[model samples]
Every structure is written in structure tokens, then in C-alpha cells.
Target: MQDNDITVLVVEDDDIDYMTVKRSFSKRKIMNPMVRAIDGVEALELLKGKKIGYPYIILLDLKMPRMGGLEFLEKLRADSELKDTVVFVLTTSKDEDDIHYSYEKNVAGYFLKEEASDSMMSLVDMLDGYWRIVQFPTK
Candidate 1:
């Protein structure tokens, strides 16, 4: 798999955070297409309705207005069709419970949002490398 072969779904309610992701991707030269959802409910709608393609990864935030990341993960895991979807938790929450629950729900990784722009850039670079080498199940 290559970077262009995968899509990224970012579920975040904060506009600044979303922009940060975009900026980081740009800074890292990660050209993969990115889709945004304001919350878990919207993300679910997008996924369940086939609004997005396969071989995509999700960047999920734990806090939101309508539905949260944990709730979203529960729902996603319950649905057999989406159970294997790759998800990574990106949030400001440093709470141990949040970390544990996110891992319990099978997130690919959990990252804190307190890092600077440079950190985000590094994250995008790492993800780009990961998508290039990692193989995902075909739809």
C-alpha cells in the first residue's frame, strides 16, 4: 500500500484541531485524501452509508457534542462490517481511563494533542510511512 492508496477520516469537533491536522499533512507532504466529521454520529453516518472508501484510517477525538469517541467505538465494533476498521485516538484527554478504554476498544494507537506543530508533522510523516508499508484487508 502507498500513501495515496489510503484515505483518512478525521472525527473532531474542534475547528482548530482539524486545521492543525490539515497543516501537519501539508507540512509533511502527505497527499492522502482526508475527510472530516464533526462528531461520532456524523462519522458513523459516513461509514455506515459507504460515504467513504475502504483502506481508510480514522483519527478520532474522544470528546464531542452529539456522540463521543468511546461510544462511537462501541457502535463501530458492534457492527460486524466495521469491526475491523482501523482507528487511532487523537485527543487532549490524558486521563488514564480514556487511554484504557480506547485501547480496550481496539484503537490502533492513542496520541495526545498537547504536542507542538512539529510533533504533528512527525506524526503525519510516521503515518505516511505506515500506510505505505501496512497492508489492509480489501473491501
Candidate 2:
């Protein structure tokens, strides 16, 4: 894959979860860059950076400190610059409201964290395929 094939930004607060994701990516031999943010605020700042680069997919955790995922999504969705970025909520929440709200905000996908790691890997692989093989509108 080219350097710009797909960049992933993982917005998660839990350190353990972050490590798990890293380990999973390594185990699966994923070659894509995986940027990380501990909270929504940091994620936004990172996304706004001039040199950080575009994130093809965001693995978001809904419940986080320094602004939750929903609030972050609301702000991002309303922003003209970031509205088109693909966001995928990866959370443990099974709440109907969370799901509905995330979808309403135009998230590209949602996945339960408790599901098997293999399932998560499958999604990541699919995402890689989409971003690497499919043509998307570029800036």
C-alpha cells in the first residue's frame, strides 16, 4: 500500500484499550499508520494540525474525558472542513440513544469493542480495502 492509502486515528481514553489496539494491529500485521488521541479534545486538535495528515477512519470511544465522543462528533459534523471525514464509533455502549445519535451524526460505521478481536480485524481489513482499492474524492 502507498503511504497515503489509509491513516487511522484511534480516539480512545483507556490506556489498556489503546495498548490492545496496538497489539491487535501488530498481530494482524496491519501496515497502516495508527494515530491516537486520548480524548475528543486532543483528537480535534490533532485533526486540525497542518501536518498531521488525513485520517481515513476514526475508531472513536463514546465515553471519554475532556468532551465525549458525541459532543465531538456534533462539533465535527457541523464543521465545514471536517464534516466529510469518515468516523467510526468503536465503543462498548449498547445504548439505543448512543447508536441513534452516532448514526444521526453521520458516522461511517459503528462496532462493539467487546466483540471478538477477530471481528474488529475484519472490519479494519475491509476499511483498508475500501480506502486502498476504492477511489474517494480527494482534496
Query: What is each predicted model's overall lDDT from 0 to 1?
Result: 0.92, 0.82
Pairs of residues clashing in candidate 1: none
Give the top-scoring candidate (lDDT).
Answer: 1
**Span of 10 residues, lowest total lDDT, candidate 2:** 48-57
lDDT value, residue 97 of candidate 2:
97
Which tens-of-lDDT digit does each residue in 67-90 have in candidate 2?
899999998888888888888898
Q: How far does residue 92 in candidate 2 sit from its true spot (Å)?
A: 0.3
* Total colliding residue pairs, candidate 2: 0
Candidate 1 wrongly placed segments (more than 4 Å): none
